[model samples]
Target: MARRGTLALGRHLARRRLLQLGVLTAAAASLTTEAWSSTSTTAAPRFSEYPFSLGVASGDPAPDGMVLWTRLAPEPLAEDGLGGMPNRPVPVQFEVAEDDNFRRVVRRGTVVARPELAHSVHVELHGLRPGREYFYRFRVGRVESPVGRTRTLPPTGAPVGMLTLAFASCQRWSEGFYTAYRHMAEEDVDLVFHLGDYIYEDPINPTSNARQQTVPDYFQVEAITLPRYRTQYALYKMDPDLQAAHAAHPWVVTIDDHDVDDSWAADVPKENSPTPTREEWLARRAAAFQAFYEHQPVRLVSKPSGPDMQLYRRFAYGDLAEFSVLDTRQFRSDQACGDGRVIGCEDRLDPTRTMLGEEQERWLLDGLARSRAQWNVLAQQVFFCQRDFEEGPEQRFGMDEWSGYEPARARVIEGFRRTSNPVVLTGDVHVHAAAEVKSDFNDPTSETLAVEFATTSISSGGDGADVTPATLIRLKENPHLKFENQQRGYAVCTVTRRSWRTDFKILPYVVTPGAPISVRASYVTEAGRPGLQEA
Candidate 1:
């Protein structure tokens, strides 16, 4: 284990050195020019299989434009993790139009997909009309990829009537089918927010796995290297349902613990028995972040720099809504009281202990204070309101969630008071929860500062039940918690100037290939009113 850690650290340091020397940049430039100059590459490179097998996507929409993404994965599940691409860079062309047929071509450009970046293309575009829907596609040789739909956000502070969106998270491919995503793709929404656990880093057991799809033997081991992480992403991206969700709408994403490792904290590995050093963990984090960026339809600004990636960002849908997407796992202090569920952990209430770190906290608070939007949305992971696991006077809470960082949670609650209608869209917990964020958790009658709708998982657990004994206990303990459901699904939200309504879309079963979806519960909060009411 020590030897492996040392080797991983060595590889990471070597890459850092090359980056500092600008060798990687210079080599990439030379390769790109050479690739473009090659007669075969410039003309039409032939391929045995369709290159865009993983499908196309767009995300991070602004008033002007959005980021377009596609990976040239002729053999998506190839163990090598290069997506069966050649060693050289490949030129990928993209086109955006007002219609799906491309009759009204608006933007056309070419980008180089280098082997070092897993033959992925992220085309950041601009100069587009605000609040307009556009259709985009990619071309390689004579093959044209699937046409994807994307919409630009309304002009900043512009009066908009309504904004429709769906938020989902925690889709463990090996555990269950991605049937919820198929339903989500069919929803008429302007945006989709993925609040983390995009890919599980744990090893797979196909024989026992719910999906029972054939996979490489190497997938039985945890993802630690760049190639391993890339391969894991490839496996997940190969799902048609997931691809449909990405193609159907633009997504705003943030990372959670499962994206890298199960319950991993900043610079701290969850497995401490054969504990990895900080350097080793950072190296692993870098690999995970790189794979995440390569796979997602995110902008270049989110590209990982070693272990760090700047993912926390804000988006405005005119003056109607403002989204404060947060990265809770990246810069957080290690879980207090040694992590996990606990009680009487004094370390949790420490004023200096933070969940967003000092910088992101300041940014969130500042953005909340300065925002003019009618709805201030915190698109994030984990339960934002107090969730007491223990039923009676014990007062047990999850150390890994906001409940463990009471002071930090309190500060954010104060920020919620500054906004018109603060709504928190959360994931991470497998069960759906609708709660009213109170100014004081100890007193139920205290002012309700905001409302939270924590969506259930896409498939993480097998087929979940509608309710369990644990669910009843949780509701009994937390009076502010209005509802709870243990079903695999997502949340569809419609935001207007007057009110915000969230419908919890649930799937009865995800163990099989197809499952019908239904709205199990619905909650709405009015403008200038923070608490949730049955819709």
Candidate 2:
């Protein structure tokens, strides 16, 4: 009976997720938020506390629908886990409009902001026209959230004219201000992809921080408990620039290390330590996952199932491109050779040590084989191509990357070889790099299977110089490498049927709030060509 009951619950949750995809099945031309006024707090003061301090966000866009997200945090930086809302469930109303002023409101719905889920709302609006723009907002009593703009994707297997996409990663609060995100908000782009390290795991060193932003005292320690993780996200989300980027466009995000702990594998804790035990580590991971889901504007599919969330999924932009967003931290083998720069480690040569694991590896390869999109991209964290740090005949590789698992990398390369146009979009290196990914990294003359464009960090490391001496040496050592830059910025991709162009946009200084952003370099790869060319 217990097992049967559990199965029934599982079925219910699965149906709930499926329902999110088609929630706006029957939409009224002009819906009203009047229905929610009954449940709203009537006696509350007019200006007791403004709840929308953390701002509003939306993400995970699909052809039919996208997720609209906002959490009711009356006092955002409260010491306790609660966002200063009462213990009871709050009624939150949402509106979707064709115009920014809400003059042409199309969809309106009321959803309960439950206490268990941190008084947040994830309104998945479906049944809308494909490739269309929409504005959304949330209302709780008299307070209203800022209106956010978002757009849906083109229909499946359909061709798009052109796509302006930007990707970035690694935003450490203490390192610098979020000037890159501020710049990104002003760009004319359809969507954004944050490929991980969205929030650093370590606490902010306030004394050393140049930016005068106030990080709450609660987040001064590394996040471990549920409250700590939630607090960390709240503090980061309070930044106006980060909120601006979220409000401007829908984001597709995945987390690397720092969201939970540093360099955490499937169930292994940071630093390869087994002190916490598997069960304890999973519990901690569950808290982190729940906190992540609560804050971000992600789809219901990636919602936490205990410690595990289904983050590795595919997003299609008509027939022009297909983004196979992967989760490298989950289901990956531990770093080989003591987890550092190792020279010729035979342990890395073991084919059995999987990076994407058996399930995700099979899913990725099968998806690549069946995809009809012109450009098939691996939107994921970590470096896809091998990076040998030391300049010598005895090659050295970063143990944390795909280089540590050669056979798995070879499998991915072979799969890419069979595709139409394979491109890898990577982050977590904290520096801009472009490379020709060969089927076999041991032999550069071997067939080039894919081209990789790695974006630099957003504010993880402080302001960076254009080119360091070490970068020059590494570029010389790796002959197949095309470009390298040590600058804080993002990579913008302009995609068409004929070619894909990537511009490495850089910020000279991030230690201050208003730094000038410029294009450091630009590269393009023509159709049928797997290597990069200077634009």
Q: Identify the leading candidate in terms of TM-score.
A: 1
Model 1 lDDT per residue over 1-535, tens place: 4864574464344324322222122212111211121223454457667788888888999999999999998887788888888888888877887765566889887899888889999999999999887878777765667667788999999998878899999999988999898777767678999999999998998577898777888999889888989999999988878877787789998889989988887788886522388888899999999999999989999999999999999999999999999989888888898768898899999988889988999999999999999999899998888888897899999999998899999999998877778889999999888999998998999999999999999999988999999999999999999999999999999888899999999998999988999999999999986788997
Candidate 2, residue 439: how far the Cα is off, in Å: 2.1
Judging by lDDT against the true structure, name the best candidate: 1
Residue 60, candidate 1: alpha-carbon lDDT: 95
TM-score of 1: 0.92
lDDT score of model 1? 0.85
Q: How high is each candidate's TM-score?
A: 0.92, 0.91
* Cα shift from native, residue 176, model 1 (Å): 0.8
Off by over 4 Å in 1: 1-44, 273-275
Clashes of each: 0, 1
